[model samples]
Target: MPDMFCFQCEQTAGGTGCQGRAGVCGKKANTATLQDELTGALIGLARTAMNSTPTAETHKTVIEGLFTTITNVSFDDEAIECQIAKTEAAKQAMAPQCSSCASKCVRNDNYDMQNLWTDNEDIRSLKSLILFGIRGMAAYAYHALVLGYTDDEVNLFFYKALAAIGEELDADTLLALVMETGNVNLKCMELLDRANTETYGTPEPTKVTMNIEAGPFIVVSGHDLYDLHLLLEQTKGKGINIYTHGEMLPAHAYPALKAYPHLKGNFGTAWQNQQKEFDGLPAPVLFTTNCLMPVKQSYSDRIFTTEVVAYPEMVHIDEDKDFTPVINKALELGGYRELHPMTGINGGDTLTTGFARGTVLSVADKVIDAVKAGAIKHFFLVGGCDGARPGRNYYTDFVKQTPKDTIILTLACGKYRFNDLDLGEIGGLPRIMDMGQCNDAYSAIQVAIALAGAFECGVNELPLTLVLSWYEQKAVCILLSLLALGIKNIYLGPTLPAFVSPNILNVLVEKFGISPISTPEADLKKILG
Candidate 1:
């Protein structure tokens, strides 16, 4: 048996699941075991979805069921057990005609992840991409559902991809499937983009202060915009201010969300720093998605979970999405007695975001002019998940070493590493551009495509380098998206995927020009050479 601490989930401290008698949140070993069973059953359901065109309900069920097993979500064994049973029921329902068939396929037996994890490295990496990419895609799907937005193609692919992962497959086939994950993810992301823009209006360039104004307020974290919208609606006229945290930082960019008078500012950096940043906070915190680290006892009681996020003893608001309990907790906490001043890790008082393609392309003329004049020598997109691993220092050093003339466009939790550092500017533009959450990688891609068009070059030929650090599935999908664009020379780190076999890695290296991070100095030399 492994020790008690495992961070296998996005919010986990390390990459492995806590395998002790109980998880950090008091998740019993039995519960973790059952969660594994739930995951296995969901995979089976995905297999069913592959063979048949599932209903709308089936798509939503697959997304929610898989997402629930993500880290820091449901620790309730009973809830997980119910979900497992529900998944099994779904599998049976989808294959109702097969029960009486003489041809009984034993391949439907539970697909153990151990087989995937322990498989040949290349196959493992490809399968890992499919599995993790879907897991992250499920979060996006769940958020889209919250806003009454759903896509048939996006939903169906979840089944197809999940089922594929369960089947015994070879390297070349799995590699193609891995790339397809990126293609499907693009559709899934488009659905979410429509959901957010339709619901909240397209995001505009906005400035967010680091200071948490004095007043009763609620700090909202995670990547779900619908939850933020609902909380903003409920908190309207309630004198409670709302601040975005981690991946939620980008929510401040949307026109509908930014229009709220009480939607004050951002709270903290990335998920990894939450335990320290949220300690003794006077306002309640609401988690709307993944990348939630283990909650500390100090602030656990004040935390609330909506959607799939759950923890032992934490109040989980159901689908009703009513935020009254969270609001009341903030009201009771009474927030800060005075206007407390706060700054980012770099002592910058505020961080301006919402520079997605819409805003960036709107000013393409100035950007192009700067590039033509040599004011901007390069563009480095240093983004992705921020992990606790010692290897993660590459991001910090990479950003610090970026040429002074280069502009750094960043999104997701990875920006926390360098967002605070005032890297100055190229021309009149701030060198360090915070484009928003992980899903906002869509915007980064858009910007790159626009820039390439302006310069009459492909995205790969442009001076932009995507140096990413991935720790979870959302990162997986985002990387897939980059590859789908035929953008090569991507530098990925802090460590390669555990599931990626040596042969698979070699293929990536030869085909995509993918290289693991060396030292910042050496990698920078190679990239700039």
Candidate 2:
């Protein structure tokens, strides 16, 4: 009879966890309960698979189940219920003997999320880290899997991590697992990087216009390139233009994808602005992954979702990838009449991307020379997800206040806040470099390691700072990976996670020097001083 509890995102109620009729992400209480049931069932399946050998199907189930519960991924109770059924079926097949056991030991059973939700504060915080971290990592893994890649270690760890969540482990034990989640996520991210680069050639630097061309068009959002590829192939020569939106903006940098003649330009800003950007647009928007906000009535008819993304009553494109319905919708809408001019949040008409690790490191000698010559004083990796919170403007102000002599590398939706601002260039490199999507944090990490190697110093010793904004689980896992690598002095905002207990927060501050962001002026002064 009471409302469900959820605070896994920055938009949680009042800077605390959301404990109300619906999540700030627009997830209803019934949907939240179904997601919890799906999670619990996945845990039960993991417990069963811990004793039995896991099949590829087992790993796939674990990945999809976790990904389904990620904030903003799914809002359909039926889809989550279907996942729960599949999880239960997998458990039954894996350990049929347990069902008939006379003893009621309950060795492997579904974990009531309420237990972890109501556990001791510290334990809850630690377990939440492992759970949320895996949920985020699962998204990356799912993407890679769709592209024909998977790591056995990463897959098995999902079972181990889920089982640990159901255990009454001590603080130290859970803490170790929490850190292990981060360490494993780094490997998972690496696997995804390889999958992406190998599938679509290493991204090259390219400029993307924000203007949407006239005529019928479909806007593709989210991070799945394979889906984009299929859609492009299907729509080729159909008089329909395709444009990237949200995290898909970087898809234009892929040599294979960019070659598509009709894959026009980007349509909208970040994912948070979709409702406003897509409203009454004479085009269909296809969501291939997370960061989908609740659809509004104004644009509901033009919305189509594929893969794990779902909303009640919206048309879903299945794995077959037949996008005819979407194409038809686009044709029906017929797009803008004249050449419709669209600008980014910064009022700029174009954005540049593809500054991934490969591209950046290719010009490493020039960058090092510039730094040595005092042409470039510092580097700031100011990137993460963008949210509806007003404090998120801090990222905009931080980049605006950064000295011209510094380079700001950004990724994910957060870059939308200032991607269009002309920060000028340093040594032929734009002062503000867009680094693909959030998973391209892999690219950023690679660049950092290379720079440290070039300077013969540790990453922390380099004249570089990481100021990140968190909104969802992917940010959680990425932060853990940084901490796991002993990278410190990171500034995080708009606020600390509500799930972090006070003692755990102290440990993070004392051990890692993690600091919540202050005013852009003060933080910039502290960093640049």
For each candidate, how many residue pairs have backbone atoms clashing (under 3 Å)? 7, 0
- For candidate 2, give the lDDT: 0.92
Q: What is the Cα-based TM-score of model 1? A: 0.92
Evaluate all candidate structures by whole-model CA lDDT and list the values in order. 0.80, 0.92
- Clashes in model 2: which pairs? none
Top lDDT hit:
2
Least well predicted 10-residue stretch by lDDT in candidate 1 = 2-11
Tens digit of per-residue lDDT, candidate 1, span 1-529: 3234334434343344455687654466776677667667777787666666677777777898878766556776666776777777777787887667788775455577657656665676677778778888888888888889888877888877877877878877887888888888888887887788888877787778888888899989889888888888898888999999988988888998888989889897778778898899998999888766667889887988877676767888998888889989999999999988887766777888887777788889999999999898889999998876677877888898888999999999888887778778776788888887788788788888888888999888898888999877788788887787788999888877655557777877888999888899998898889
TM-score of 2: 0.99
TM per model?
Answer: 0.92, 0.99
Our tally of clashes for model 1 stands at 7
Lowest-lDDT window of 10 residues in candidate 2? 99-108
Error of 2 at 100 (Å): 2.8
Candidate 1: give the clashing pairs: 6-17, 6-18, 8-16, 121-500, 121-501, 122-501, 125-499
